[model samples]
Each structure stands twice: as structure tokens, then as C-alpha cells.
Target: MKVSAKLFIVGSNSSSSTRNAVDMACSVLGVAQLDSVIIASPPIEDGVNLSLEHLQPYWEELENLVQSKKIVAIGTSDLDKTQLEQLYQWAQVKPNSNQVNLASCCVMPPDLTAFAKQFDIQLLTHNDPKELLSEASFQEALQESIPDIQAHEWVPLWLLRYSVIVKSRGIIKSKGYILQAKRRGS
Candidate 1:
């Protein structure tokens, strides 16, 4: 299956980490060979905080990336309603299969999910850097928690997204596995 995966790397402080996350997300979405990534630096250029002015450059790239009919996974921190709206506008161009991979600390603005729903975009949230771990306890915890969770809740997406981040960060301490996306019309 040819799954289109889009990864937005927000607050990527280093080139190496950013590259690894992109590579891992691509693998998870079953499109590693395709390399469809969108790197969104935090709105703040020199710090962790968000500054709208700083995101202009990223906006251009984001607009271009979402033009495809592939699934997009955004790896970002918290965003307000306005920022989320901007993202929705960009992703709406193609619609259908889109995933927003965000940090655990970054709660989905009330309207982000609603906005995405309009286009059938799946808003996926992930763990912050501190939560990326491959320990047995972590796996066990996830196994126990996922079933009871609702899609609107953040845990499900957080775990899945974190796994990709862990692999990309080279912190998994094991060989990585690729996630294949189901192909279109399959």
C-alpha cells in the first residue's frame, strides 16, 4: 500500500533530531522510501516559545506539503486556536487522511478537532520529549490504556506518535520497525 505520510517537526532544535524524527515517522506511516516530511520550527526562532511572526517561513512549506492526498503527521508542541486554524486551512487542501502529531503538553485547542473533522483529517497527539521510552512498563501501560480510550482523548495518539519519536531520536536501543500505510483503493 502506498500511504502518504506528512510529519511536521516543531521545536526541532537540532538537525540530527529533526532528521531522525522525519525518518521514523515516514517509516511508521509506511512511506520511508517516499520521504514526505514538513518541518515546522516553533514560531519562535531562537527559543521554545511560539511567535507567529517566526512561523511565516514554515507556513509556506506547510502549504506546499499538504497539497498531496497523503496522510500528514504533525510533530508539534502546543498551539492556540488561531494557529490550529492556520494548520487546518493548510491541510484542508487535500483533506481525507491527515494526522497532527503534537506533544503531550500541547492540548488540542477545542476547535482544532472540529476543524479537522470537516476534512476528515485525524488529529493525532503525541508525547513530549520526556516521555519517549521503550521500557516494558511503558509498553504494558499502553497496552492497558488504549482500549478504554476515546479518539478525542490524547493518550492513544500520544503513544503511537511517541513510538515514532523514540525511534527517530535513536533512543529505542533496538532495531526499528517500519509502519506501512494502507494503499489507496486497496
Candidate 2:
């Protein structure tokens, strides 16, 4: 099967630097054509940070955009079950599995991990090693110990919201045909 590359940017802050990083990465990685970009509101803070409640206001607009377009990237630091459920309900899409993608530096709580598994989501971890290993035996052992990976079955709707925000802000470009096709499919 052909796998369309869909990038999910979780825990993204709304700072200029954060936005720029995502934009730059999307451009360099050529992620604009693959799927949607989702941006969750930053968490609330004492005049210091963006909070989830702060993001709630934009939820409707974000949802509209996702429904209109078909991208699937989202930015949010809050990944708790309650929030996840709310997002799923808002997007009107049921998550097939609780699987989540783990990129380098993204830390997840053990309880959350267990919760995700209970929901039937597999945790996929990807690490980019920059250094060459000197021990071939150790490398072989590591390779033998790693298990095979599989894709999750469900796509969350809140992810759709995040994807729309990313597209609206021009962090990523939307694919016209794919968006149209997705809308029709829905």
C-alpha cells in the first residue's frame, strides 16, 4: 500500500521561533503536500505561556477549516485522555486506535502510554541517530531486539483542527485535490 506522509506536530508553542521552526521544517521536509497541519492553542500561563483554555476559542474556526480541507497535523502540548476525547468529539471522527508517534525528545507519561494501549493505539517511536556506532555486535543485538512496527487504525478529528490551523497560518501548504477528495469522501 502507498503511505501518504502525514506529519503531526504535537506540543508546539505559539512563539515566533516555534512557528518558524515548524514552517522551516515543513518546507525542508516537503511536508506541505502530504497532509494537514494541526495547531493547538498553547496552554495558559501567568502572562508567560499559551494555555489549552486559551485555544478553546479558536476551536470552531479550526474545525471548519479541517472539514473544508483535509490535512492532519496538530500542535498541542496537552495530550491527556480527556483532552484527546474532546478533540475527537469536536472533529467528529472516532479514533480507531490509541497509537501515537514518538519523535526524538518527546516524552510521554507511562500512565498515558497505558491509556493509549487500552484504547488500542500502538506507540511508534522513531529516533534519528547521527553518530556511527563502533560496535557492530551491539548494533546487531539492538536490531535483533527491536520489534516490528505497525500503523494504527484510527485517525482523531482534533488532529483535523490542528491541521487546519497550520494550513491557515501558511506553516504548510494544502493539497487541493486531496482536500477535495477527502471532503467528498466524508
In terms of lDDT, the poorest run of 10 residues in model 1 is 151-160
The best candidate in terms of TM-score: 1
Kindly list the per-residue Cα lDDT of model 1 for residues 100-149, writing each as its tens digit: 44543355655766766765655555343532432344446545767653
lDDT (Cα, 0-100) at 107 in candidate 2: 75
Which candidate gets the maximum lDDT versus the true structure? 1
On the 0 to 100 scale, the lDDT of residue 72 in model 2 is 40
lDDT of 2 by residue, 1-186 (tens): 111222222222233323333344345444553243333233343466433355554444434434544334333333466665555555543333333335433777677676666755444443423211223333354446653421121111211111223534555433321100011123
* lDDT of residue 131 for candidate 1: 28
Q: At residue 37, what lDDT does model 2 achieve?
A: 37
Global fold similarity of model 1 (TM-score): 0.38
What TM-score does candidate 2 reach?
0.34
Q: In angstroms, how far off is 124's CA in candidate 2?
A: 7.1
